[model samples]
Target: MIFGKKKFLAAVGDFEKAAGARDGEAAERAFAQLYQAAEKAGDAEFREAGPRLAALLPSVPQGPRAAVAVVTGACVERGADPSACAPAIFAGARAGFEAAADFCARWAETGGGELPEPDDELTDEIIGRTGEEPAIGWFTLPQWEMACVAMLGHRSVRRESAGTAELLALAERVTEASGHEFKCLTYALRVLDDEPLVVLHRETGTGYVLRMTGIGDNFQLHTLLAGVLIGGQHVPGDAPSAQEVAVCRDAPGQVPTQGSFNLAGPDGAWIFNEGTPSDIPVVDGARLLVLDPPPYRRGWPAGRFFPGMPGDLVLDRVLDEAEAAEWFAKVQPAKG
Candidate 1:
């Protein structure tokens, strides 16, 4: 190994100490030497310490893209395994480290710099998040207002890139929620100002652009109309599309599904699902209880389950159930 453990540590310290530079130069400088040294070092110690050195990226306050340049640029220089560096950067992105997201977008904008196809999960993780790969921060919207549904008919896609595929996934989910059988014709996904936007093609004309905006707890996103096309004419909208999409938070369209589900566990018991508009929607169709949707599971995933639901009225959860248990016995109802 060319670079000693102490040397790698020092480089990492420099990067940590110099967070969010006007430009990523300082961090890059520090990381550059360490990465290059690690690849050529003759001793086993140098090679072993490299991945550990890469781990420092996540802990830094910002400049995720800088950290990326440090790691992957090293790969470009002499072919080093940049996998371990990805999650560390991902952790930064999850924490809302601005530079991390920038780095992801930048990396996607510019491919992995010819670093061979992903070799492992870590590499794949980086690719997936960069918006270059699929499902990086991808979310599905359950409710889309009816008016805009018509445009999807002629919508055709050119390719899936960045936020493009994710938006398409959302469109597919929202279309599904509307109970409309359809397909996504993705054209391109471009991350503009950190937002993932997609452009779609139409049969009669060119197409339109749509963006996904994340707003709410749980994995939820809403679509925003950004651009449009009419007979090959590109008409960029100065204002956001008037269309809207939302989560149907009400108990169910059927309104107050009645019956006792008798959930098995009390502490961990909850039954609910993301409400997709289906005639026999699982989350709403006459069930006694509701549970929060299980992580990453889509079909009728519960938003919240009415645990120990023994009340008949919708106000019961706030009144009757609370009163019966004397949980809020002193509280009075609004009417009677």
Candidate 2:
């Protein structure tokens, strides 16, 4: 709203005062205002004070959650370019938080060999791109670091239990709001659920197994981008042995225990089992033990479903009530 020198200084003062008091929420609130003022500041004003503002963000009293969301939302509210401020925000944040540490372990790859510093040509090219966020992701490491930090920060603080569709929707919202298509980060929040994710929604628990396929969805990104977002992961649809699958039904007659039938090879009973007009007639009291990751953590980024990473998704059992509860006991639910 055309914030001038006086308003900007006042907002900064408020943030410092709140952080000094160890009032994280209040500090974040003040930081939100400061970020807004930074956006509204004129070209000259931003050039003059942006560096100073950026220098201060690392030490700001970041709250328990949504610190990145708060900053992005402020940029969205003012219709400011998120890239304009991302560098400073991230440089100050990467080492300051634990969630960023977790994210780095998974995503901060030294890929394609060492990345050279972005020269003016590169910066200008980024600024000229139709969709890329300038000086942010895919540019400098600091901006990339910032993007990841914010993403994890949002996850740590997010209070919503989202499915695949809902997470995609939020990604769209963040893009519309901040003019930044944070594809990797936004999608990761929903797909990964919690980092080291381990939970299930009843709707998706069944759908997850039902939709589990080996690979090759027309080599498309949209079809299974969620899978890849959690980690550079893959889930094998290879079924356990017949001996492994032979179920010990608890009851003699109880609506053929709803489950995913895994077969021993690429072509077998499992595929035909899902075929039309009943081949292997189902009666009552059958058991199914589908071992896969929780639905939220099932996506394999970049279509990597085989030759996967450690801890991608293994032994995630979709057993009957008694067995499911037992499996849930061994894994500790993730703590913020």
Error of 2 at 74 (Å): 9.8
Off by over 4 Å in 1: 1-26, 42-55, 59-87, 92-336
Question: Which candidate number has the best lDDT?
Answer: 2
Residue-wise C-alpha lDDT for candidate 2, range 1-336, written one tens digit per residue: 325465665676776678668787887777678766765555544343444444455555333222443444243223333344444443333332222222222222322232224222344543343223322332332343334334333322232322324334544543443344544444333323212212222222321211222221111112222223222223333332222112110111112122222211111123221221112122122212222232232222222211110112222333465544543343233221
RMSD of 2: 19.1
lDDT of model number 1: 0.29
> lDDT by residue for model 1 over 287-326, one digit each (tens)?
1121121233122222212111111111111123322233
Q: For model 2, name the residue pairs that clash.
A: 227-299, 227-300, 227-301, 228-300, 228-301, 234-305
Residue 110 lDDT (model 2) = 22
- lDDT, model 1, position 170: 47
Q: Relative to the unseen true structure, what is the C-alpha lDDT of residue 332 in candidate 1, on a scale of 0 to 100?
A: 25
